[model samples]
Target: MSRRGQRLTHLELLERLVSFDTESSKPNLALMDVVCDYLEGWDVPFVRVPNAAGDKAAVFATIGPMVDGGIVLSGHTDVVPVAGQAWTTDPFALRIADGRAYGRGAVDMKGFCALALAAVPDALAADLRRPIHILLSYDEETTCLGVADTIARFGADLPRPGAVIVGEPTGMEVADAHKSIVTYHTTVHGHEAHSAKPMLGANAVMAAADLVSELNRIADAMIARGDASGRFDPPATTVHVGTIAGGTARNILPKVCTFHWEFRGLPDLDMGEIPALFAAKVAAVTRERLNRYGEFGRIETVEEVAVPGLAPEPGSEAERLALRLAGRNHTISVPYATEAGRFQEAGIPTVVCGPGSIDQAHQPDEYITLAALDSGAGFMRRLIGECGAP
Candidate 1:
């Protein structure tokens, strides 16, 4: 039994959740174990979808009558790694001080997951005319690898809800728009020789520098393209290289160079333009550099993953329902990407609303204010009152 009046159940649940280190690189089965046990105790039937390796899984469950026109509450169980981050408190253990709870996933976003799990008892007690669904996914901290396969099972192995509420950190406001994300891994291959002989070998590092320069020029042009709505900061698509590795020694010319990069575009923006242009540049490098001695000099760019942005839909049923539940009359826009876009693309009206702030996400000593969780609790409580909700 959940003690809604006690106010500690949600906090306690968050503590328990953060205790398990479900970092994207590690197996999330332990966290899934806790979730399955909780749903079992509630006697709620759920569907489990595991990755091909069975190292991770996603859990989906429904509460109330088995019917259409239901609502789905979605959140991910994985958090980013705290490997090199400096923190005053333990990232795996929950700590409380100054009306804030500190932990790795406290704000983005085990806080919302705890609140959703803690509200099951209240939802069970209410005389709901429509059902409520819970979607707990894994590997969201990475490239949303876990949820992609799991969402494919929707409406086949699982009930297709009318609307989905993605519990990403939104400070308890309804968010209907965000930016799309596209990631790529680029590798340049060339012939190696001693640095003393410049003409004998093709330098991959130099080629990579040229590619990076071209990417910067494209970024500037995108900024010139501009956002007409003025909702996004900088009001343009942004490109950046996150990681790069190459070279064996300073004296030897680099034969291989690899880098991981991504671009963020506004909603409804065509994401293929940047990659297409980059491909053209890569071909030019390959054609011009390849010769009798440099037969292997080439470049390759592969799409790691692509996540669509959540588009703003005015007067959407999801918007109206979320506004009423959150006690707000309007919606807002964010610059982050969430699984809400996937649901929306699948024809399910979707919105993002949850606890905490995005600024605290992936930062040292991350915490969610007790007040923020209180606001989340109020939203969940109102969600349970669906019988009379607009």
Candidate 2:
């Protein structure tokens, strides 16, 4: 395809992709259908790694030699929900104006997906020495486990790639490090009693408040410790509470309270450290607050989501290749969590480099500029040259 043709095809694919309402809570099989069909039209072989429930899937396709030492281009198909956002146009409909393409996933990921798909013909025409694999997964906005099943297949039923480039909205910067995210839900169980009753029952709401306060103290400590490498923007591993619910009436001691909390850890921070501190606080809260009157209350916590961080691999293949292709000399760290960590955990060197700014992602009118898209296309072309016949 000519340059114009490629640009047109990229926009067309982005339009088609953004049409599907593949929110994190919804199934993305429909969007996968369009992707699979496009690959099929080019006679490209791919596999679908479906979730355990079979409602969603991750598609993996290889272009050129399917042997080892290939590069993997990874992107997620799911976008955040648009139900509560105020949009100037339909969130699912692609709109182009002012040199920007607007839609829910256009920048957050679908832009990179479009660029990779558009390069399929170019990759095939290169008759490359090594392969270029494209992986599209689900649930990145929520669990980030959509690629787990597919990653598990590497070196078993699938060919392992030499490096991975996760196409997150990094504005074409090569990101070698990112934070890890772990979410949790805590529930305080207490006995209900009349407000006038003293030493008769434990108050769940009060106990939950104490726990939240403890978390605040822990968050302060993390802030003081700061990021050792001084690469992160916030400069610290941070903790937050998203929601809290409890208490039926003002006159009665609440029987149950629940809250959702999470921590985004710096790459060097121990993953177990936050949980251990929170557990100790929970124990103390249960003993001193929840069950002060008797053994009338208890606290329980469940780990909900755990997404690992991407540590800096200064001289790794992914960093070197991505920086070279992106026309850059230095690497930066993103505060967001991405599936690149999953690839890193699988012993694959991985980096995050893609089009569009993270600022445009998850907003009411998410967009990717034409200039950024063009730059991404150039990057793809250079990648083809690297793996092409030499």
Candidate 3:
């Protein structure tokens, strides 16, 4: 590690990383550059996969020799926005209060990333037989774009890791499966007239309300018929409408209404059915309205993002290796989604284990306990030793 004293302390690294404000809406190039410099200092060869806009990028660094099967240490570089969060201190500045490092990404992530970087020196100094890959991705908070690029590189330009550990905030718990996230933005178009002349104009808000009711019905039905996999909480898919916008004035009929909704699906649940059901409901509702109005009304659903869920594969090498390395006999399921599923879908075996508690993630004044950091560091040390890195 660092001769200065086993690299920087976790809090120190957290402070530096938190100061960068790598929010999902903004570019993370500055933070990526800093990480690149640290890797280069250790003589690690890395490649940059920049986004099409060239504003943000993912950094992939390989330690040990290039090989067919290695371990990929993955973490997202982005943090959620601090907008409207009632923080006691600056959200971008790490504040240690009551034995906690309070900051936007201290618990959600960045802490794990910092710990991985801190362990880099130790990994670099070891004699290694197989490679240890550091996979830092960007835009994970936005749409899971960065990990997708990293996964696409596997077995082609990139050496596919035998196992991938997604370092999300899971309190060092080994998560084998989680729900998938699918977000949709829907718009409804209707003719507008004076509110007093309700008969003369189609009401967009009314149509949106009908659609939302249908969504709720669909969600209830899914819950009643739970998925076969009993791993997930609620044991089924869940749908929620998060945001809605419509009329500008109470006196005027709304011409357009829009809403954002999402669904978290169990691993075995098919997401395609959700939209299809909604579409069928919308078609029926709109057909009735069109027949009444002698005109057509429009309802459009646009997919904002879709993140797949991790399906438990029995006798999978990924799970077997993770259990062996983590010294755990069983795998647990998490409610949150990670890049693990994306990696698994790319034909790469993946597991989820990391520092910090999911309870602290995305909350005001978030923190990762020092004990979590220590445990994660130890995990990395063992991983490097097992990989035969010197």
Candidate 4:
């Protein structure tokens, strides 16, 4: 096909992908169906690694010779919710105007998916000595664990690739480092009493307030510690409280109160440090505040999601390959976390490089510029050339 025809195909595939509301909360099986069918048309060998519940799956497709020392292109199939965002165009329907394509996942991801799938023909024609693998995973916006089962199969029933490139919108600039994110939900249990009674029951709301204040103190300490490497924005690990709710009436001592919070840590920071500090505070708060009224209440914390950080691996195969394909000499650090760390943890060298600007991701009327899409196509072409070499 001609160059123009290939670009058109790429846009069409993106349109199809965006049409599916593969929100992190919903199942991505429908989107996987379309992807599997496309790979089938190309005669690409692929595998479906489904979640334990079997409601969703990750599709791993291979082109050229199925062997070790290949390249893996990874992207998540899930997009964030759009319920409250004010979008000029339909968030799930692809709309092209002013040299850009607008959609929810167009820039955050799906764009790279289109570019990779569009190169299926070229990858086949390249007669590559090293295989090119495309991995579409689920739940990256939430847990980042959707790739775990597939990564586990590498070298067992599947060929383990030498490097992995997570296609998260980095404006085609290679990224080698990012922060880790862990989310938590804390609940305070207390006994109910009338507002007139001071010592009869513990105040859950007051206890929750103390915890939130402690979290702020922790956030301040994290800021003071700062990023030692000077690569992270905000220049420090960030602690945030997203939501808090509790209480029945203003006059009553609430029986339960819950708050949601998270901390994004620098790659070099010890992951256990923050949690340990919080645990100590929880103990103190439980003793001094919640149970001061003779075991009238307790505090409980549950970890919801923990996504590891991607550290800089300077001379790694993934970094070198991505930098070369992207026509750059150095790598960058993305402030956001991604599934790239999962690959690195599996012992595969990994980097993040893809089309479009992350500045457009997750916002209302999100878009990927046409020029960026074309640039991504160029990157894939060069990769095909590299893998095709004898």
Please tell me which model should have the higher TM-score, number 1 or number 2: 2
Could you tell me how far off, in angstroms, the CA of residue 324 lies in candidate 3 after the best superposition? Answer: 2.3
Clashes of 3: 9
**lDDT for every model?**
0.85, 0.93, 0.83, 0.93
Better lDDT candidate (2, 3): 2
lDDT of 1 at 32: 83
What are the per-residue Cα lDDT tens digits for candidate 2 across 1-390?
Answer: 223223247888899999999999999998898788788878888999999999999999999987988999999999999988999999999999999999999999999999999999899899989999999999999989999999999998889999999999888899999999999999999999998994789899999999899899999999999988989989999999999999999989999999999999999989999899989988898888877779999989999999999999989999999999999999999989999999999999999999999999999999999999999999999999999998
Best by TM-score: 2
lDDT tens readout by residue for model 3, 38-122: 7777778899999999999999999888876988889998988888888888888888766677788887789888877877777
- Give me the runs in candidate 2 sitting further than 4 Å from their true place: 1-8
- Please give the range of 10 consecutive residues that has the lowest summed lDDT in model 4: 1-10
Cα miss at 17, model 3 (Å)?
Answer: 1.4
Q: Which runs of model 3 end up more than 4 angstroms from their true locations?
A: 1-11, 194-199, 248-252
Q: Alpha carbon lDDT of residue 327, candidate 1?
A: 85
Cα lDDT of model 4 by residue, 1-390, tens digit: 123223347898999999999999999999998888788777789999999999999999999888888899999999999999999989999999999999999998999999999998899888998999999999999899999999999998989999999999999999999999999999999889997995889999899999899999999999998888999898999999999999999999999999999999999889999899999988998999888878799999999999999999999999999999999998899999999999998899999999999999999999999999999999999999999957
| TM-scores of the models, in the order given | 0.93, 0.97, 0.93, 0.96
